[model samples]
Target chain A: MLLQASNLTIGYGNHIVQHHLNLVAEVGDLICLTGLNGSGKSTLLRTLAGLQKSLGGHITFRGKDVGKLTNEERAKLFALVLTDNIAVENLTIHDLVAMGRLPYTGWSGNLSANDEKIVKESLAQVNLLHKSESLICEVSDGEKQRGVIAKALAQDTPLVLLDEPTAHLDLPNRIEIMLLLRRLSVHTRKTFILSTHELDLALQMADKIWLMGNDGVQVGVPEDLMLTGKFQETFGSTAFRFDETDGHCKINHLLGTLTVAVTGESPATLWLERALFRCGISVVPNADIVIEAHQGCFRLQNQEVHSIEEVLHHLLC
Target chain B: MNRTYKNGLLFTGLLIVATIVFACDIVFGNVRLPLSALWSDDVLYREIIYNFRLPKALTAVVTGAAISVAGLIMQTLFRNPLAGPYVLGVSSGASLGVAVYLLAGSLLPIAFVQSGWGLVISAVIGAVLVLLMVLGISFRVRQAVSLLIVGIMFGQIAGSLVTILQNNSNPDSLKLFVVWTFGSLSAVSWTYMQVLVPLVVLGLFLTFFIQKSLNGLLLGENYARGLGINIGRTRLLIIISVALLAGTTTAFTGPIAFIGMAVPHLVRGLFRTSDHRITIPGSILCGATLLLLCDLATQLPADGYTLPINAISALVGAPIIIWIILKNK
Candidate 1:
């Protein structure tokens, strides 16, 4: 095991946000922690990374209690990428990443040849070697995040903990970062435990999922958790239903026992049914109201509507 | 250009310029002495050279270096570009100390406030008091922006107290106090230099020890801890160093302005790096040179009168602060 938290309690001051929680992270495992707003995900990550004191219980990394280790020793075992904004100015990417070697370097933080090699390798791993000389302020947000991840990688720790690593990124960038993290775990065997709101991506890529909610914490693989109905139980809402097979959240609409036949083999017909479902209507062959959606037009109840908007207006009227 | 090569060239260039400035400051003052006067048979010229100009120039160098380094630490600790000893009320605290001694001590014997040790002690105590209060508030409020506001409030409080003292002071004492507040390097006699030199040197040495930790802090307190820095200890050390530098310099030469706040920015622009390992030393050298130049500028050679050193620093410093604000935006 890379890290294990047994019966852990975490919170700030006197308030306990999470209690009696147990989690075990194996080597090379990509664990994604998902929770609602203010659900102790960040607090738990901070505690496990040894950046904060746990109120009770023990966190052991490599079979040793975390509280007993000195700060330098803990740093050798864990590296963290937080959501804190980087405020430094005129700092190059190489210089920023070189700071990760503070635990191993001398008091002056002068990087040795081996340390330089490691910095380069980490930058290469993040695919940011080309921008190593660029100032941090000159880089895009996605590139800055990759630089931060590269800094964490340069620490040479066994486990890396990141909070909202894909928070502000677009879809392509978000997917790219997830793939990069997965690849790093597979190729370098470094364990990653990150908290994120990207459920579909988390479900697709994570080796383990830790879900936190009002019912306490649930830990399992994505498929097992979905099969056991724990995912829906933890994150279910009155407005939506969790699609178990497709791993998606869809609007929950009452069909009202009234259905309209949806005709035509094109994608327009499928979208017509979707619009109808959104309005609490369903598709059936024997219903009085029938709609046929061809290329740019909709035929509803013998009335030809040129657009989906017009079709919905005509059917509802 | 390679950053290392650029840093090396800039460091060497600063050293050369500081040396030239030091010599020029000693040579050209209110009384322009010839460079060959030391080797001449004139005993008065020798006395002025050894006892007056040399000490004054050295005082400027030491005070400049200390205050600039203090300002650099303040900028990093608060993560505010405008943070400095003067702007943060540390110097105002020193000024309040001097005000109390000069204005309130009027009821006592003349010898009480005139002693060099008395002034230095009172000023150090005052600066340390304000430093402790600021540190206390910073400990409670983790927000840098709020801490900055608190510092400015402290400055205002100290400034108002000094104003009250000035209003209540006698005319003779008020005139003396006004001149003192204007700042001067020539007032630092040989006796003060003995104390000032070692204190400034020690403060600069302490800066070297914390440079790496200061680099870790560039991101913020949380990230610094992740890199194994004891944030509380670092903060304490920084406060102590700033107090020593600012308090001692203000005590010896009065509250010299702008050198502390502007030199670090100048060094960063010159070196093009935010790493403190370079900036700390860079600020020290750049500070020494800039203040030496300012000292030279204060001497009205043609009119045989000197402008207030405080005025020159503000003239030089205020624009730099404005530029930094605009650049950051």
Candidate 2:
């Protein structure tokens, strides 16, 4: 057991956001904390990072009470990559990552050769070594995020906690960050606990999911939680349905006045059904007007159309 | 390696400039004395050099270094570019103390109230009182910006109190109070330098101990804490150090302006890095040099009349700050 928390309650003064939480993270486990907005994902992460005081219960890291440890001791045990944007001017990526060695450095924060090697290695791990001399403000947001992750890596802690590491990133950048974290966790054998709203990616990638719901925190393997309908129970609404097989929360379209049958190749048909759903034309097995969607063109009533717009125009007209 | 070499050159150049300015400030006063006059047998020149010019020049150097370093710490602690030594109302508090003593001290029958030490003691006590209040508020407020706002409010309240005291003062005392507000490096005699030098030295020394903490704080409080810094303790030490440096300087020099607020920005621009290790010493040297130059400018007319050091600092420092802003933009 790397970290364990039993009967933990976390909140601001006089207002409890979460309670009766029993959570455990083993060595090398990528635990993804997921929840609705204001469901205490960040609060829990902060409490676990020892940045905030837990209202009740105890958090033990390596069988020792975390609250009893000194800040320097805790810093060696776990590092954090915060969500807050670092807008500090004139700080280079290398300089920012070098600060992670401060705990082990001298009073003046002069990095030793060994510390420099570690900082360089950390930057390389995040693929930011090439841009090490770039000022923080001069870099792209993805590069800045990588620089922050590099800083956390240079801390050389056994556990890394990230609060919404994927937030504010586009799709490819988000996937790249997640993949990098996963790779680091596997290669370094270090535990990572991150809170994120990316349910699809979290469900596919995380070793375990800590779903913070209305009742309490439900901890389980991602597949097990999905198979047991816990994801549906927690996140299912009138507007969307959680797909158990694909591990996706898909929007539930209302039945429309017009019905049309979508046919042909799977991926194309899938988008055609979506377009029909959006245009208030429900997809059915049989209809007077049938549309067959190929890769590039749509065959609607034996008349070929080049785009979904033409198909929608034929159906609506 | 290249950056370090450049910084070394910058420090060396600044030291040379500061030395030249210090010598100029000492030699080119109201009664312009030649370099050979220091070794002359003339009793009047010796008296002027040792008793008046040397102490005043030293006071300007110490005042510049102390207040500029205080401003740098406050800027980092509050993470506000505009933050300065007096941002926490320490100067205004000292001003209020002097106002009450000079304008209202006649009501008290004590003999000590009329002495120079009475004014210094009162100013320090007033500054500390405000510091204690600000420190108390800091513990309750989580954000540095909030503490900054509270400090500004404290300054406003203290300024209002000082104005009220001035309105009711006698003309003789009013003239004295107004002259004190004009600020003078020459007013600090050798006796005051004994106290001022050590306090400023101690404050600057304390800053070296927190050099890493100040750098960590530049990333903001949460990140600093994650890096194993105790934010509350760092803030307390920084606040105390600022109070000591700014409060003591204001007490002796009567609240010299612009040097504290403007010097750190100049040093930061020159260094092109926020690393406290560089900026701390850089600020000390740059601040001392800037004030020395300003003080020398006040004596440049070579007339017997001297301009207020406060006015000279503003006139000289403001344009440099404006240039830095425009260059950075």
Candidate 3:
């Protein structure tokens, strides 16, 4: 196992946020952790990164307890890229990324030719090479996010855990960030686990998904998850339904049929549907259709009401 | 990288400026030494330069550098732009310690001779005690506002205690405390300078040596922790450095204001980087220049009178802070 949490209970004070959680992550996997806000996802990641202490169980890295490992030992295993920008008003890109070598550098990074090469390549990897001279406070939101990733890449840990890495980015920036994580997972053969709200994107790139829901947490391949109809049980309520087979969410609204209807064979049928929609009536596309000429409609099955009075009676009924 | 070079250049420029300021400082003080008239064998000139004036200027420069660098470290570590050695109640706490020592001296014969060192040592202890209290409050409160409020409240408490001590003391002791409170470079005699300068040098040397760690601290605690820095340990190092730098200066100069708080921000504004490797050293030079300038201004001695150095610094520092905030807006 690259990193393992065994029977761990993590929380603040006596509150007990997550209890008896067990998980193992292998190298070279793109893992996505998805949940509602305040579901203890970030806390779990912090614990795994050794920033927070577990209440009862232990986190094992390479078969050794994480707490017992030296600081150097922990640094070799994981790098945590936080969501907050840290706002170091004066730090340069190169200098910020070089902070990764602190473990090996002891007191000074003492950048060897090799260290310099690695730092340059890391910036290039994130497409931030041009911003090396830029101060942290001067960069845009997207560039700041890239700068953070570059710092993580410089650390070059086997397992990288990011907390809501895409939380503050725009749509395009979010997709690009996810793709970057995917590439890093493959190119370096490192495991990347990130907690994010971009579920569709997370589902797209993830090798394995950790989905937390009302039905409790589940982890599996994306296809397997979709096949099991977990979304319907989890996110779907009375008002919302995940069209599992169709792969889209739908809302069901109740409104009686309109007296103003048209034949499917005519162009007027489309106009009739639009007219009903404008009147706050949902046009269930495949529902019954009636042709209205001279302000009268009759049911095909019952052969009834050919007048406006009968249609008004039906609406009252 | 450009900013680093810019910082280096600015720092050099400031060094030349500091030298000029120091020369003007030495030349303009109460008994002006004629720069052209003094020879190597001139007895009065030697006495005036070595015994009286030279130590004061050097003390001003070193105190400025030390206190400013210390303030920068405090601001960075706490991640609060408003944070300073004096702001965290250390100065008031140190004052309380001095009050204790001065008050104790009236009842005992040994009090007068040992009182000077006694005030300084107790002041350091008092500052450390308050630092711990602030640290404790910071741990419990995540909001910077609450922590700052607690700091201010703590300062009030220390101030009241020091007041009580001052009122209960003899007339001579009250006079000494009042002088200390006003803040001065002239009161720093050679013997006192011997103790003060070495402490400042040592504190700053240790801070510069840890420049890499300071840079890591710029990246936030989790990012820094991932790089194998023991966050708890680094914070301890910072506190110790702040204590040594602020404590020693407060002990000698009687809580000189604004040097620690203002210099770092001015350096950051000029050099435009948060990286401590340059910022720390840059703040030191800016501090030295400002202090020497203030020292010189205090020595104008119009009609045989001099201004308190603290008054001059507070007048300058308050608006620089207000300006930085407004500019940021």
Candidate 4:
């Protein structure tokens, strides 16, 4: 194991957010830490990353107590990417990434040729080598986050920890970041512990998931946790329900007992069902009210509606 | 414009400018010693050129470099654009320290806050006291903006204290204190230079050692800690270095203004890089050159008397600060 946490309690001051947490992170494992806001995801990450002292219990890296390691030693073992927006001006991606070599570069921090190569390799890993010369202020938010990850990779630690790496990113960019992290974990065999709100993506990509809540912490593979109904127990709410199979949230509005039969499986049919479900109505295989949804149009009860809005209006009125 | 090329050009350009300004500051005064004056045999001219102007010029250079570097560190440490040695109350604290010593010399032994070394000691004590207070508050208040407010409050409180001392002071002591507050480059004779030069050089040398850590700090405290930077130790080191630079300069030259507050922004604008490796040295050079130029502007009227150095610095510095705010906007 690259890292192990046993019987751990994590929190700030006297407030305990989680306790009795036991987990092991092996090399190449991409573990996603998922929890509601204030549920100790950040606190746990901070404790494990050695940014804060653990409230209780033992955390070891390669059989060495984390608390025993010097800061330089811990630095060689773990790299971190934080969610803080960097307000630096005129700092280039190259300089920012090169800073990761601090522990290795001695007091002067003058990067040697080997360190330079590592920086380039890290930036290349994040596909940001082209922008290495560009000032940090010139980059988009996603690119800047990637540049920060590149900095972590340049640290050359055995483990990487990130907090909300996907926050404030567009869908494609969020997927891109996760895929990049997962690929890096596999290719480099580095242990990764990331706390993020990208649940569906985390479920699809993570090797293991650390679920935290008021009830406590649950550690298991995504599928195992899903099968055990832990996801539903942790995330289900009056306004939303967790879909275990797809690992996504669905609106929990109560639908009327009456059902409508939708004719086909297509974009139009999907929209028709979505519209019907949104109006507290469900579509089934058999019902008195039948809708034929085809290319760009919907035929509801023998009347054609040009748009979903019109179809909803006729169906409800 | 490639970043490396731009940094290189700015560095080389600033070096040339600093050297020229250094020479200009030494040569241009009531007695305009030409570049050839160094070779002349007139002893009086040599005395005026070497003993008088040389020390004054060097003091200006050292003062400019020291305070601006301290300002850059404060700006980075607090993650605030407006944060500087002056705004954070380190200078005001130094001012209050000197004011107390000058006004109450009968009460507190004269040997304690005497002249050259005495002022440096008192100023450092004052600056460090304020620094400790700021650091104490900073530990509890995580927000850089809030910490900035605390610094401004410190400045206000220090200013009020200095005003109280001024009111009670005798006219002779009061005039001296008021003149000191106006600030001076000419006041640093060769005797004071012996102390001022080494402290400023040492403070700047220490900066190179912490350059990487300062870069880590630019990412904010938690992230810096994650990178294995001991934030508490680093913060203390920065405060001490700033104190040495700012307090010593304030002691030797009195409360010279604006270089500490404005030069870092001007350097960032000129070089367009936040990397402290570049910014620290860059601010040092630009600060020295700008202060020298401002000193030259002070002597431009050639009235045998001089304009207050603080007024010239503020005239130059205040506009740059406004430009930065507008640019950021």
Number of the top-ranking candidate, with lDDT as the measure: 2
Candidate 4 collision pairs: A90-B274
TM-score of chain A of each: 0.94, 0.96, 0.80, 0.95
DockQ preference between candidates 3 and 4, better one:
4
Writing each residue's lDDT as its tens digit, candidate 2 over B1-329 gives 88889999999999999998888888898997999886888999999999998998898899999999999999899887778899999989998998999899888667887678988888898898899999999999999999999999999999999999989988998898888888889878888888999999999999999999999998888888889888999999999899889999998888877788788888877887888999999999988988888888888775898888888988987787788678778
Q: Count the backbone clashes (under 3 Å) in each candidate.
A: 0, 0, 2, 1
Give the whole-model CA lDDT for all candidates, comma-separated: 0.86, 0.89, 0.77, 0.85
Name the 10 consecutive residues with the lowest summed lDDT in model 4 chain A. Answer: A240-249
Global fold similarity of model 3 (TM-score)? 0.87
Q: Write the per-residue lDDT of candidate 3 for residues A1-317, one digit (tens) a residue.
A: 78887788887878777777778788798999887777688888888888878788978877888899877778877877887567766677877787777776646546777777888999999999999888777888878888888878888788888999988789998988999889888888989988887767876799988776633467788667777977566565787665666555556544555544444433444454545544545545344644343334444334555653454455445
Candidate 1 - chain A - TM:
0.94
Q: Supply candidate 4's per-residue lDDT for B281.
A: 91
Q: What is the Å distance of residue A208 in model 4 from its true position?
A: 0.7
Q: Which clashing pairs does model 1 show?
A: none
* Top TM-score model: 2
- Residue B112, candidate 1: Cα error in Å is 2.5
TM-score to native of every candidate shown: 0.94, 0.97, 0.87, 0.93
Ranking by lDDT: 2, 1, 4, 3
lDDT by residue for model 2 over A1-317, one digit each (tens)? 99999899999889999999999999999999998889999999999988899999999999999999887888888888998768775788999999889888878888899999999999999999899988898898889999999999999999999999989999999999999999999998999999999999998789999998977988899999999999888885789888757877778877778888888998888888888887778878988778887778899888999988888898887
The ten-residue window of minimal lDDT in model 1 chain A covers A256-265
RMSD to the true structure for each prediction, in A, is: 2.4, 1.7, 5.4, 2.6
Ranking by TM-score: 2, 1, 4, 3
